[model samples]
Target chain A: AQSVTQLDSQVPVFEEAPVELRCNYSSSVSVYLFWYVQYPNQGLQLLLKYLSGSTLVKGINGFEAEFNKSQTSFHLRKPSVHISDTAEYFCAVTNDYKLSFGAGTTVTVRA
Target chain B: DVKVTQSSRYLVKRTGEKVFLECVQDMDHENMFWYRQDPGLGLRLIYFSYDVKMKEKGDIPEGYSVSREKKERFSLILESASTNQTSMYLCASLSQGTNYGYTFGSGTRLTVV
Candidate 1:
């Protein structure tokens, strides 16, 4: 079984400031990690995923996440954030076929 | 590009009504999932179908059922619509051996009154 933990429920940042959303997961063996973003009233869109080969994976909208095996963490980071980047981000892990999601972190960007 | 489409963007149903939510994926993916998104709870999987007529229960599956009669379509049924069942429902599909994750539909916001 796999479980994901997103520490912060809400994160507020000003426009153009860098932001990082923390995510942690626990599993017995290898797993696939993913970060998904959901805009207001929209479905989830895959931000990035870490399957194999690469520890640092980049996705759309200039967002990136690094997988740390020692720390059991996959934290999402963006160099600079915009108001349009505000959305709910979820961290999920799947050991087999089923994916388990964290509570979620709501990112609110301000000008 | 893979596309998952949900039947409705918004829906309203009265209590005790039998409600159906439809999802279709053009990718011909073998896996289809039904999830409900709430305020505090991010996304809870209700049910998933690996293939036509083959289904599996997810984390939370009470008060809900799923049908996959065809390869490209999956349906979620609310046996009895209650206020607690009101939520944002999402449908997603995954290819058999794809590296990328599931492709999600736009989602249906169902409000049970």
Candidate 2:
């Protein structure tokens, strides 16, 4: 079975400041990792995913995440955040047909 | 781009009413899922269908059921709506072999009175 744990429940940052959200997972087999963002009253949109090949993957909205296999972590980072970047983010892990998701981290960006 | 469409953005119902939430995917994806979102609880999977007439229970299947009569459509049924069942319901679809992950609908916020 695969499960995900988001280390932080909420993060507050000033506009144009850097932010990082921590995520970790545990699985006995190889897994696929994903990061998704949900704006207020909106559905989740894929921020990025790590299937294979590279340890570092970039996604839309200038967001990036690194998949550390040894540490079982997939942390999302953005150098400069905007007010629009304030949203809830989720980390999920899947080995086969189903995915297990973390509780989610809510990012609130203030100007 | 793949699009997943939920039937309604918001709904209100009285207790003991049977409610059906519809979802359709234009990409003809082979898998569809239903999940409920709550404050601090994130998203919990209710059910999923891999193919037409093929359904599987997810982590939280109580008080809910799912139907996949066709390839592009999946419906979530709340047999008897209760106050506790009020939540934001989200639908998503995924291609069988792709690694792009699931495309989600805007979600339906259902409030039961």
Candidate 3:
């Protein structure tokens, strides 16, 4: 079975500041990684994904994640964040068709 | 736009009552999933369907059952609703040979009292 571990439960950042959410996964075989964001009272939307080929994957809203095979980590980062970036972010990993998600990290951007 | 739709945004049911959470997707996807969201637990899969009339148990399937009579519709049924079953229920769909990236519905907040 595959599992994901998000290091931070919550992160607070100032506007225009950089932010990074750490994520690690446990899988013996090849795995796929993804990040999703959930706004208040809304469903989750895809942030980015690491399927194959590139280690650095760029997603919507100027967010990106790096898939480090050696570290078994796929961390999400943004050069600068805005107030609208306040939401809950989840890290997920999958070896099979099913995905296993971390507990999630709540990012709060203060102006 | 192509999206997944859950029947209700919020639902309140009594204990031991039968409850149904309906989900529909318009993308002609072959995979549909049911999950429950809690405060600390990000999301726990309840059930999933790969094709019409085909179902599979996810991480947590206890006290939950699912029906997929049609390709677009997947229903999650609670035979006997319990207080512990109160949570945000989400529906998602995807194509085969894919993982992680899914189109999720708005979700249904169910309260069992």
Candidate 4:
């Protein structure tokens, strides 16, 4: 069984401030991690993915995540966020053929 | 680019009524998945299909059933709709496999009264 844990349920950041959404996973086999973002009243869009590459992967919207295998973590970060960046972010891990998603974290970017 | 399309944007059904949620993918994706999203619960997979007539139960499949008769369409069924089943249903498609990126639909908001 593979499971992903998103450490934060809600993250509040001022506009232009940096933010990080923490995620961790537990898996026995090779890991595939993904980040998806959902704006209000919208479906999820892939932010980034880590298959098998350099630990650091950059994604859309100026977001990036570092996959630390030893730590079993993939944390998404942005140097600065805009008010439009407020949305729900999801972390997902693969279990063989299926993808298991975390509970999710709501990012609230306020000006 | 892949486009996963859910048939309905909003649906209101009475309890005990049968509910059908339709999803279609345009990219000839081999993998299609149905997930329900709720507050605090990001997205819980209900069922998925890798190929036509082939379906697999996901993490949560107790109250849901699915039909994938054709390669491009996947349907989620609530045998008997209930208030607890009210949530946003999302349809997603992966071109290659789980390792590939997923394209998601806008979602269907189902409300069972």
Candidate 5:
């Protein structure tokens, strides 16, 4: 069975400040990792994905993540955030066809 | 662009009532999935259909049932609605291969009283 863990439940950052949301996964087999962002009352949108390539993956909205196989982590980061960037972010791992998701981290960008 | 559409945005049902949530995908995706989203829990899969009339149980499937009658339509059914079942229901679709990502619907918020 595969599982994902998001270390932070909530992260608050001021406008123009950088932010990072940590995620870790446990899987016996090889896995595919992803990051998704959800605004209030909206569906999830894909941020970035790590299939098999370079460790660094860039995504929409100036978001990026690095896949560290040794650490079993795929953490999302943004150099600078805006007030509109406040949303809930989720990290997911796919084991075969089933996808395991983390608890989610709420990012609040204050003005 | 891929689009997945759910039938309802908000629904209110009484306990013990039968409820049905419909989902349709225009991308002709072969895989369709149903999930429930909660505060702490990001998204828990309820059921998924790899093809028409073929369904599989996901992480949480005890209280829900699913049907995929056509290639583009997948439905989630609640035999008997309960307060605990009230949550945001999401539908997603993706291509068969690994290179593509999932496209999700707006989601239906179901509240059982």
Candidate 6:
């Protein structure tokens, strides 16, 4: 079984400020990592994923995440944030066919 | 765009009533999943099907059952709805390989009274 841990429950940042949301996972076998963002009353949309290759994965909305194997971390980062970026973010891991998700991190970008 | 559609956006049901949440994917994906999302708990998988009539239990499958008679449709069933079962249910589908991301439905908010 695979599991994901989102270190922070909530993070507040001022608009145009940089922010990072930490995530870690535990898996016995090789896994794929993903970041998903959900806006209020809407479904989740894929931000980015780490299947293989470059450790740094770039996603939409100028978001990027670094996959650190030794640390078992896939942290999401944005150089500057907008109020539109305020949403609930989830980190997920999948080993074979099933996906394991983290509790989630709520990012609040205050204007 | 790949679209995953859930039958209802909101549903109110009495306790002990049978509840069915339907999900349909327009894409011919091989894997479909049913999950419930709760505050501070993210999304917990209830059941997933790799193919028609093939189902596998997920992390929180104790209170739910699933049916996948067709390739594009997956249904989540609550035999007896309880107050605790009231939550937002999400459905997602993915292709066979690992490169594609799962497309999710808007979700169904179920309230048991």
lDDT at B2, model 5: 85
Q: Write the per-residue lDDT of candidate 4 for residues B1-113, one digit (tens) a residue.
A: 78788899999999999999999998878889999998998899899899999999998898899999889999999999999999999998886655577788999999999
TM-score of 5: 0.97
Q: Among these predicted structures, which one has the highest lDDT?
A: 6
**Candidate 2, residues A1-111: lDDT per residue as tens digits?**
677899999999999999999999998788989999999877898999999999999999999999999999999999999999999999998887687889999999999
What clash pairs does model 5 have? none
Q: Give a tens-digit lDDT track for model 3, residues B20-81.
A: 99999997888899999998789988999999999999999999999999999999999999
In the range A1-111, model 1's lDDT, one tens digit per residue, is 688999999999999999999999999798899999989877798999998888999989999999999999999999999999999999999887788899999999999
Q: Among all windows of ten consecutive residues in candidate 3 chain A, which has the lowest summed lDDT?
A: A92-101
lDDT of 4 at B50: 91
- Specify the highest-DockQ model's number: 6
> What TM-score does each of the candidates earn?
0.97, 0.97, 0.96, 0.97, 0.97, 0.98
State each model's C-alpha RMSD to the native.
1.1, 1.1, 1.5, 1.4, 1.0, 1.0
Better-scoring candidate (lDDT), 3 or 4? 3
Q: What is the lDDT of residue B5 in candidate 4?
A: 84
- Model 4 lDDT per residue over A31-61, tens place: 8899999899877889999998799999999
Q: What is the CAPRI rating of model 3's predicted complex?
A: medium
Off by over 4 Å in 4: B97-99
What lDDT does candidate 5 reach at residue B20? 99
- Tell me the lDDT of candidate 2: 0.92
lDDT of each: 0.92, 0.92, 0.93, 0.91, 0.92, 0.94
What's the CA error at residue B96 for candidate 5, in Å? 3.4
lDDT of 6 at B105: 94
Retained native contacts per candidate, as fractions?
A: 0.56, 0.59, 0.56, 0.76, 0.59, 0.79
Candidate 5, residues A44-111: lDDT per residue as tens digits? 98999998889999999999999999999999999999999999999999867677789999999999
